[model samples]
Target: MKRTLHTVWLVARRELRTRVQTRAFVLGTLFMALLVLAFPVVTLFAGASNAPEDELSASDSTTRLGITQSANGLADPLERKAGVDRPAISVRKVADTETGKNLVREGELDGVVAGTPTAPELFVERHVFPHLERALTTITYNNQLDAEMSRSGLDPEAVRDRAGRGEVAIVSMGESQGAADGPMAGISDAEKAQRLIIAMISTFLLYMFLIMTGQMISQGVVEEKSSRVVEVLLSTIRSTELMAGKIVGIGLTGLIQFAVIGVLGFTAATATAVLTLPTFTVAGLLGWAVLWFLLGFTLYATMLAAASSLVSRQEDLQSVITPVIMLLIVPFFVGVSVLPTNPDGTTGTVLSMIPGFSPMLMPMRLALGGVPLWQGALSVVLSLVASAAVLWLGGRIYSNAVLRTGARVRLKDALRAS
Candidate 1:
């Protein structure tokens, strides 16, 4: 056991050292950190841009309404007489009716209230803009109210306050405001959904790390085979020992890379005020991330190590690895496309329970919110069991196939050799 552990450690150290020394790894780390930082920055900008602009547009059939008088003076008189807070109406006297119509069409003027020798007639070139519509609605409603109050012999001040009363509160029984409020309440209605997204993103990221590192493991294995390094290494170490060492070494290397990225991302988020990291909360998101990350890395890395041993040639890697890569990718898209809608539904439950998919699915379920302690515990237990089985099976496959050269090894041949 001590020998196995020592061999694993040695292999892991070698793998870790190789990665840290590589230019690709350094560049990849920088790229990923930049991307992580970019996400929140982009989100902040998008949120700011989506805010409503305070601009108004109004129009009538043809004539334009020019408050030929001072806007402030008109607003006060209109407020006193009609009990309406009319917005500042500026006048633009054009050459003729056509020019006035042109200005209205160009959206330079709001509604043109044409003062004929008779009564006033309003004209708009087209449909109203939202801000203009709202402002118009308010002024019109107040004007009508003032007219009604004048008929009823009520003061305009008394009428305006009564008209602007707050709306009635209607509380429903057995309904959560969080769930019922529209998409805006997604944080509350779909806290679980948010959590699921985070979990899936994290899991997929870890899965990707394993895949990249696994490829490195495979390349390392192939390099040794091609260079006749294995022949010398085998003289000192058994095949199983060598395979074990490679797996442990490569996994540790992957974890170190993961740790660097994770730390950078976490620090970036906290420093940028994206996420608030707490001191001592047992179920805090950061704590969950740390726990789930370790579990996810361990589970995926074992399978990747095993997958590497299935082919000796670099050219054969795509064929041998396609299925395993698909296994990692399918759940990722599924989690993103399907899980949010049905957090506790069929997809979530099935994927979370499945041995190969549990690492991705379980965390997603938790993030979408409301994974019971027992369910999480069961998931962890299942993942551990699955990891053990894959490791055993994969190790056997590695032991049987690592020395083989030329063509890719079939699963049947791998199993038969085992």
Candidate 2:
């Protein structure tokens, strides 16, 4: 047993050294790290550019109006009706109707109030602002109503006071309930949005990592078999050990790249203030992502290596490994398309607990925050169980088929081989 472990370790070390020292691995890692670092910086500048425009719009919200002598009495009422919620009304007295019209046309004012308080006429350069128009209309209507009430021997001020007091009481059930104590409790809308972003990013990275590493494992196996390298290696180490060592070595390489990218992305996002999540929260998400990757890579890599061993040439490797690739692809599309809008929906919740789907879906739910502890624990357990079974079965197929060269060996023949 000790000798077997020593052989596996030696092979793992050799594979790791070969992969890490490759030009492709070094350049790919550097490029991905740079890209991750640049994302937050780009977002920060884009937001910065649009911020000034928003501030300018808010600072210049006052509506300027000109009033002629005929409508001079309406000024106080209009000011009062404008209220604090609507835009502030800036009233200027004009000499005559023509002067007010000229002021509006010259862009010096938003609108002109002429005629009389009860029969006011508004002139504007183009369209009147909605709030300003509403205020003017309300003031005119009140004046006419007040005059009618006075004619009828009713107190207009007393009537207004009673009407003002008859406001509809608003009772919001959502607000009254306060924050929920269950999953998704107490999370603000902004935080939810941030969680969704984190979920999406996690899903994408896992998908890419799985695809890249799965292919690497399959191709590496086929390359060794085709070139008779496995024959030489097998003479020294058992087939199972060779397969185990390759999976470990390639997995570690992928893990290194994955960690570098994740750390760089989080660091950049935090430094640029793009992500408002606490450091521990971000770190926890990253930790979950790493865990899922290791589990996913193990389960898929074993099957892919076993599949590739059936074929001696790289050309036929795709036919054998396409099904495993599809397994990775289906969950990726499902999670990315469904989870963003409905992270806690029944479909995601259930699928995330399944072995094949969990690695891709569970991490997304966890990153979105509010996933129950049982669900996360169950998914991990199921995946580990599935991986162990696959590893055992895949080891048999690879051991029987890897040394067989020439035309593609059927899976049944490989499994049934002595």
Candidate 3:
């Protein structure tokens, strides 16, 4: 057992050194790191660009209007009708129509009102703002109605009082009743949005890492077999040892790259203020992501290595590995498409617990927050179990078929081989 472990460790060390020294690995790592760093900087700039406009809008909350003498009575009614929800209205008397138009054009006032209180002409730089327009329309209509009621010998004050009291009491049912104490409890809308972004980004990175590492393992296996490198290595080390070493080494390499990227992303996002989640929360998400990557890489790498052993050449590698690729792809698309809008939906919740799907889906749900502890625990347990089984079966197939060469070995023949 000691000798076997020593051999595996030697082979693993060799594989890791070879992979890390490659130009592709170095360049790919650097490129992905740069991209991760760039995302937060870009988001920060994008938000900063619009900051002034938003601040200006918030600071200037009052709508100033110049009203002519004929419409003087509207000053009080306009302010009153503007309502508590809308911006405050500040009305000032204007000398005449030309004067009011000049003030509006000069930007000293938001708008101008002329004619009598019942029949007002509004002037502005362009179109009237919605709140001010609504207020003017309501006040003018009420004035006309009051005049009509006076003619009919009805009390306008009583009618106005009754109408004012006829407001509809709003009852919002948009939020679930138990949301305050449920999975999403204590998270604000802004935080939820940030979490969604983080989840999406995490999902994408996991998917890419899995695809890249899976291909690397399959390609490495096929390349070694095709060049008879495995044959030479088998003379010194057992086939199972060689396969285990490759998976372990390549898995470690992938993990390093994954960690580098994750740390860069977390640092950049927090430094730029793009992510406002508690430090512990973000770190926890990163920790879970790393865990899932390890489990996912192990499960997929073993199968891919086994699948690649069925073929002797790189040309045949794609056909054998395409199914595994699809496994990764389908779960990826499903997670990204379904989780963002419905993080706690039945589909995401259930799929996140499935072995093949969990590696991709579970992390996303976790990142989005509110995932149950049992669900996460179950998914990890299932993945570990599935990976062990795949390792056993895949090791058998690889050991059986990796020794054979020439035309592609059939799956049955590989499994049935002595």
Steric overlap count per candidate: 19, 0, 0
Error of 1 at 248 (Å): 2.3
Q: Rank the candidates by lDDT, best first.
A: 3, 2, 1
Q: What is the C-alpha RMSD of each candidate to the true structure, in Å?
A: 12.2, 11.1, 10.4
Q: After superposition, how far is residue 159 of candidate 1 from its true place, in Å?
A: 42
Worst 10 residues of 2 by lDDT: 172-181
Task: Check candidate 2 and list the clashing pairs.
Answer: none
Question: Could you tell which candidate, 1 or 3, scores higher by lDDT?
Answer: 3
Candidate 1 lDDT over residue span 195-280, tens digit each:
44455656666667756876776677777776667778777777777776776676666666676766666566545433322212
Instruction: List, residue by residue over 1-48, the lDDT tens digit for candidate 2.
Output: 999888888888887899889999999889888888888888777866
lDDT of candidate 3 over 244-355, digit per residue (tens): 9899899888999999999999999987777756666777788888899999999999999999999998988889999989989999999889989988899989999888
Error of 1 at 307 (Å): 3.5
TM-score (all chains, Cα) for each model: 0.63, 0.69, 0.70
lDDT of 3 at 301: 96
> Which ranges in model 2 have alpha carbons more than 4 Å from their true place?
51-183
Top candidate on lDDT is 3
Residue 237 miss distance in model 1 (angstroms): 1.6
TM-score-sorted candidate list, best first: 3, 2, 1
Tell me how far the alpha carbon of residue 286 in candidate 3 is from the true structure, in angstroms, after superposition: 0.6
